[model samples]
Target: MSSSFERYQKRRLISSYFSVVLSIALVLFLLGLLGLLVLNAKKVSDHFKEQVVLTIYLKDTAKEVEVKQMEKSLAMADYVKSIEYVSKEQAAESMKAENGEDFMEFLGFNPLLNSIDVHIKADYVTEEQLKLIADETTSKSFVDEVRYDNDLVTLMNNNVKKISFWILVISGLFTVIAVLLINSSIRLSVYSKRFTIKTMQMVGATKKFIRRPFVWKSVRLGIIGAVVALIGMAVVLYYIDKTFPELEFLKNQILIASLFLGVFAMGIVITWISTFIATQRFLNLKTDQLYY
Candidate 1:
C-alpha cells in the first residue's frame, strides 16, 4: 500500500508539472504572436504610405533634356522611392484603354500633359513633407502643376497614427499580462512543494541550496515552454505566408530572429524570477504556515 501511494503521488506531481508547463507555453505563444504584430506594424504602415503617389505635370515648353535633368535630380532625392515619366501619348493611351474611347482623337490633339509620377519613400509621406515636396516641385520653371489626392494623404496619416498608438497600448498590456500569468503558474507549482521546502530547511539545508533545484527545474520547464511557443509561431507564420505573402512579415529575417530571441529570453527571465520569488516565499514562511 505504501509503495502504491508513493507511485500515485509521483504521477500526480508529474501531471501537475506538465499542466504548469502547458499553461506557460500557451501564454508565451500569445505574447510571441503579439511580438510579430508589433514588429510588422511599421512595414504595414509604410506599404500604405508608399501607395500615395504624387504626379508632377510638366509645361508644354519643357524640353526633353530638361525633363531628363529633373528626373535625375528627383531620383537623387531621399524622399523619392521611384519616378516614372509618362509621355502625353502614353497618358492618352492609358485613359483611352480605361474609358474604351479615344478622347484625344475627339479633341483633335493631345490635351494630356507630360507628367512624372513620384512614389515618395514611406518616411517622407507625412502631410508637412508632402506639402513641402509639392511646393518645391511646383516652383520648378518647367513644371506646370503638381497633383495628388490631398484628402487621401490626410486620412492615411491620421489612420496610421491611431493604429500605431493602439498597438503600443496593446503591447504594453500584453507584457504585463504575460508576466502575471507566468508568475501565477510558477507560484502554483511551487506551492505544491511548500512542505518539502520546510522539511529541507528543518533538516539544516541552506536556503540557497534548497532553492537551487527548484529554480533550475522551473527554468528548464520555462525553456521547454518557450520552445513549444516558438513552434506554434512557426506554424502560424507558415500558414500566413502561404495565404498573405504581401504582408511581407516573413521577408524581415532580421526582425523575426530578434523576436524569437526576445521570446526565448523573456521565458527564461520571467520563469527564473518567478521561481526564485515563489521559492523564497515558502522558505521564509513559518512551519505552521505550511498547513495554510
Candidate 2:
C-alpha cells in the first residue's frame, strides 16, 4: 500500500509538469499565428500598391520630339518607379490582341493613341500625390490628358488605410487577451502545487528561495514552447510560399526568418513574465485563499 501510494504521487507530479508545458506551448502557438498575419498583411498591401499605374496620353497633334520630351519629364519625376513608352503602333497592337479579329474590322483605322504608362513607387500612390502628378502632367504642352482611375485609386488607398488600422487594433487586442489567458493558466498550474509551497513556507524558506526553482522551471518551459511555435510557423510559411510563388515578396527568406525569431523571443518573454507574476501572486495568497 505504501509503494502504490508513492507511485501514484510520482505519476501525478509528472502529469502536472506536462500540463504546464502544454499550456505554455498552446499560448505560444497563438502568438505565432498573430505574427504570421502581420507579416502577410504587409505583403498584401505591397501587391496592391504595385498595381497602381499612371497613364499619360499624348496630344493628337503633338510632334514626336514634343512627346519624347514629355516622356523624359515624366521619367524624371521623383515618384515614378519606371516609365513604359507605348507608341501608337504598340498601342494598336495591344488593342488588337485584346479585342481579337472584330476589333480592327470595326474601327477601320487604328484608333489607339500614343501613351506613357508610369509605374509609381508604392508609397507615392496616395490621393494627394496622384493628384499632384496628374496636375503636373496635364500642364505639359504635349500631354493631352493624364489618365488614371481616380475613383479606384482613391478607394484603394482608403481601403489600405482601413485594413492597416484594423490589423493594428486586432493585433493589440489579441496580444492583451493572450497575456490574460496565459496568466490565468499559469496561476492555476501554480495553485496545484500549493501544498509544496506551503511546506517550504513552514520550513522558514525565504520567498526568493522558494521562487528560484519555479522561475527557472518556467523559463525552461517558455523556451521549449517558443521553439515549437517557431517550427510550426516555419512549416506554414513554407507551404504558403510553395502554393503561391507569385507572392515571392512574402517569402523574403531573411525577413521571414528574422520575424520568426522575433516572435519566438516575444513568446518566451510573454510566457516568462506571465508565469513569474502568477507564481508571485499565488505565493502571496493566504492559506485560506489557496483552498479556493
Candidate 3:
C-alpha cells in the first residue's frame, strides 16, 4: 500500500512538472508572436510610405526647356527620393496597357499629358511636408498642377499611427498578463514541494542554498520553453511567407533574429523573477500552512 502511494505521488509530481513546462512554453509563444507582429508592422508601414508618389503634370503649352528646368529643381528638393519622367508617348503606352490597346483608339490623338512621378523619402511623407512640396512644385512656370491622393495619404498616416499606438498598448498588456500567468504557474509548481522545503528549513538550510536549485531549474525550463516557442513562431512565419510571397520584405532575417533573442531574454527574466518570488512566499509559510 505504501509503495503504491509513493508511486502515485511520484507520478503526480512528474505530471505537474510537465504541466508547468507546457504553460511556460505557451506564454513564451505568445510573447514571440507579439514581437513578430510589432517587427512586421513597421516594415508594412514603410512599404506603403514608399508607394506614395507625387505626380507633377506639365502645362500643355510649356516649353521642353522649362519642363527640364522644373525637373531639375524637383530633383534638388530635400524630400525627393527619385523622379521618373513619363513623356507623352510613355503615358499613352501606360494607358493602353491599363485600358487595352483598342481603348485608346476612341480618343483620336493621345490626350495623355507628360508628367513626372516623384517618390518622396519616407521621413518626409507627412501631409504638411507633402503640402509644402505641392506648393513649391505648382509655383514652377512649367508645372500645370501637382496632384496626389491626399485622402488616401491621410488615411494611411492615421492608420499607421493608430496601429502603432495600439500595438504598444497591447504589448504592455500582454506582458503584464504573461507575468501573472507565469507567477501563478510557478507558484503552483513550488506549492507541491512545500513539504520538502519545510524539511530543509528545519534542517537549518540557508534560504539561498534552498532556492538555488529551484532557480536554476526554472531558468533551464524557461530556456527550453523559449526555444520551443521560437521554433513554432518560425514555422508559422515560414508558412505565411510561402503563402504570400509579396510579404517577402517582412522576412528580414536580422530583424527576426533580434526578435528571437528578445523573446528568449524576456522568458528567462520572467521565469527567474516568478520562481524567486514564489519560492520566497513558500519559504515563509508556517508548518501548519504547508499541509494546505
Q: Rate the local accuracy (lDDT) of all candidates.
A: 0.92, 0.77, 0.85
lDDT of 2 at 80: 82
Cα RMSD for candidates in order: 3.3, 3.5, 3.3
What lDDT score goes with residue 177 in model 1?
Answer: 91
Best-fitting candidate, scored by TM-score: 3
- In terms of lDDT, model 3 sits at 0.85
Pitting candidate 2 against candidate 3, the one with the higher lDDT is 3
Assess the local accuracy of residue 8 in candidate 1 as a C-alpha lDDT between 0 and 100: 99
How do the residues 111-224 of candidate 1 rate in per-residue lDDT, one tens digit apiece? 989999999999999888999999999998999999988899899989989999999999999999989999999999999999999999999999999999999999999999
Ordering by lDDT: 1, 3, 2
lDDT of 3 by residue, 84-190 (tens): 99998898887778977755578688777889999998788888999998998788777888898889888999999999999999999998998898878888888
- What is residue 282's positional error in candidate 2, in angstroms? 3.4
Q: Model 2 residue 210 lDDT?
A: 84
Give the TM-scores of the predictions, in the order they appear.
0.82, 0.80, 0.82
After superposition, candidate 2 runs with Cα above 4 Å error: 1-19, 32-46, 96-101, 237-262, 286-289
**lDDT per residue as tens, model 2, 55-93:** 988867889888777668767877887899888788877
Separately for all candidates shown, the number of backbone clashes (residues 3 or more apart, or on different chains) is 0, 0, 0
